[model samples]
Target: MIPATETPVCEAAGVRVVRAGRALLDDVSIALHAGELLAVLGPNGAGKSTLLGALTGDLSPDAGDVRFAGRPLKDWGLGELSRRRGVLLQDTATSFPFTVREVVEMGRAPWRRTARAAEDEEAVDAAIAAADIAHLSGRRVPSLSGGERARTAFARVVAGRTGALFLDEPTAALDLGHQEDLLRLARDRARAGDAVLIILHDLNLAAAYADRVILLQNGRIVAAGGPDEAFTAETLSAVYRTPVEVIPHPVTGRGIVLPLRG
Candidate 1:
């Protein structure tokens, strides 16, 4: 875990957003520190994606500000911002017939004409291997399944090699094995000093992999802390409006959440 004193790669302070007169985020603040995996969890329409949009500068906050590496987000040029952070949104649609390798190579566009451009091939190859998409390298992107397309998009982000990564529901289309693989890869990235903020609905996955968690409801943070502190039965049951149970793992002692079924 990163010390609280360390400067965050990205931070939002007292951010607020209103759309069509309805507040989407209210007084929201969060930070992404190097070497830490922060998970954002909330029910549908809980402003999880709004927070991500604010942090990424895709959606301007009505009230507060976002800073990237100590500089206001507005100060960073598009190219520099691309090099500093990689974002993987929920949609990864492709209209063109670009091959998987071609799509991944596009991630290096921001580094063009720079010294880092020399590393493009190496980076792309490594990303392909990391995402386990080498077999689909020559396949056209539009031909791939939802999960395959997701992996291809992730490979593109991996090839970018940005200092911070923002993934919004990246595991939604993935199978059980791919979900584990992707989260493990994300955890590895955090361990290697990348600030990673991911939005997830899987309570167990967040409990297992997140260093810290923020649970949001009605555009406000309902809870924030380590897994053990934030993921109690009482907290989750109330926030999710469902009966749930939290038990300690037999070996790792991490919390395991199970929802009560009829």
Candidate 2:
């Protein structure tokens, strides 16, 4: 976990987004610091995606502002922002019939004609291996399964080698094994001094891997703190509208959330 004393790599201050008389995000404020994996959790329509978009400067807020590296997000050039952050959104589709390798290679576009361009091939190779998609590197994107396509998109983000990462429901289409692998990789990235913000539906995964978590409901933050603080049974039950139990893992000491079942 990053110290609260450290300055954040990304920050949203009093951000609000309204669309067609509905507020998607209401007075939401959050920070993403280096060396920590921050998880955003909520049920459907909680504005998780909207928060991600606001933080990444893809969606402008109707009020307040966002900043990266202490500078306003609006001040950064698109190319410079691309170099500083990599985003892996829900959609993982290619416009053309690009191979997995080609899609991953596109990540290096921001670094072209620069010194970092020399590392492109090595970065792409490493990202492919890290995502375990080397086997599918030659396959066309449209030919791959949903999970495989998600992994390919992840590999592209990894290849970008940005200082900060935003992944929205990255594990939604992944299987059990790949889901674990993806979170582990994201945690590893945080440990290696990158700021990672991921939107997740799995409470246990967030407890296991995230350094901190923010819970949203009705387009506003209901809780924000360490896993144990935000994943309390009462808080979760209230937010999810379902009774749940929180227990500690025997070995890791992380919370294990289970819904009540007859």
Candidate 3:
């Protein structure tokens, strides 16, 4: 758990987003504190991505406010915001031919002007190594596998060296091994005091790695708390509209859910 003394890195208050005259998110509020890994879980059309878009400032809310470090998100300049927060979307598919190194270098664009005198080469190298893609830096992005491409995207975000990271279905295309690696990387970043918010479809993986879980249903937050408190069998069954059994992991004592057809 994150210490209470550390202030939240991002906070949303009474946030509402409407698209095409329909409310996608309604009066939602959340706080992402430093040194914490928050998992946002939900089924399709649950407004998880909409919430993230609000955080990234890509989509402005129809009502309410999103603040970073106590300041309104709109108040932050683009370059400043990019340097402080990094966002990784689900699909990074591009036909353009760019090497892994070239792709990662894009993250450095925010700091390009002022970072000329500073030695940012080491940060780039560290990010590649952290993402476990150091060996593929010279390879072309188009030639990489889906999992490899995901790792490269992760490296690009990490290279930005932001204090907060927003990952949208980061492991959706990854294999088991790559998923584990990606989760570990996010966990490590959180432990080092970066506020990390990730959208995930797999309840089991969310239960295992997240310090706290936020469950979204019908574009609203149904539950928010630690794994055991938020992921009860009753809650899961109701939220997902499926029968489920919440079991304890023998070693970790964390909650895991198993679907039981009625």
Candidate 4:
């Protein structure tokens, strides 16, 4: 857990976003403390991606601001921000035929100066090993299986060694085994004092991994709290417009959800 004296890693206050003359997000506020794993959840068109873009500096909010360590995001230099936060988009495609090692090494781009490059290299090697892709390092990215490719992408972000990580549907293409592996890695990162924010479509996965859940609906935040507080059947039904059941996980005791036919 982050020390009480340290400021929140990231915070958004009354954030509002508009795209193409349409309101995509409205008056959303969130504070992400260090070492917590937060899951952003909602149905399609809920503006989850837009919210992430605002957080990662990809999109500037028309109203309100995004602050990092109490400083406006705009005030932070690009390289400085990259070193503090790593982002993984939902659609990651590499058209170039690069080796997995080469792709992972790209994470070091933000720290290419001074002695940081060497430290970045060490971090890359550690990340590859953690992702269990050391053997595939020499393989071409395009030649790998879907799961292997996902792992490679994950390794690349982990190699960045940022204090905060934002992943949008990172496990979408992975099989059950690989998905579990990735979640374990995410948990480890949080345990090691990194703030991880992930957008997940799978309620079960979110319940299993996230310490907090923020639910959105119609481009607005509908619920935000821990799994027990936010993953109730009523909240799920209202957010997704479908009846659902929240059950206790047999092992982890976390809230697990199941769809119910009306």
Please give, for residues 1-262, the per-residue lDDT of candidate 4 as tens digits: 6654678898889999998898899999988888988999999999899999999899999998899989999999998899999999976778789999998998878888757687876888998998889999999988988778878888889998888999998898899988888888898899889999999888898889888989999878998988889999998988888899999988889987999975
Q: Which stretches of candidate 3 lie above 4 Å from their native place?
A: 2-6, 115-119
Candidate 2 — which residues are off by over 4 angstroms?
none
Candidate 1: which pairs clash? none
Off by over 4 Å in 1: none
Model 1, 1-262: lDDT tens digits are 8898988899999999999999999999888899999999999999999999999999999999899999999999998899999999998999799999999999889999999999999999999999999999999999999999999999999899997999999999999999999999999999999999999999999999999999999999999999999998999999999999999989999999999999
Candidate 3: worst 10 consecutive residues by lDDT?
113-122
Score residue 182 of candidate 1 by CA lDDT. 95
- As for TM-score, the candidate ahead, 2 or 3, is 2
Q: Residues 101-161, candidate 2, lDDT per residue (tens digit)? A: 9999989999999999999999999999999999999999999999999999999999999
What RMSD, rounded to one decimal, does every model reach? 0.8, 0.8, 1.6, 1.6
Candidate 2: what lDDT?
0.95
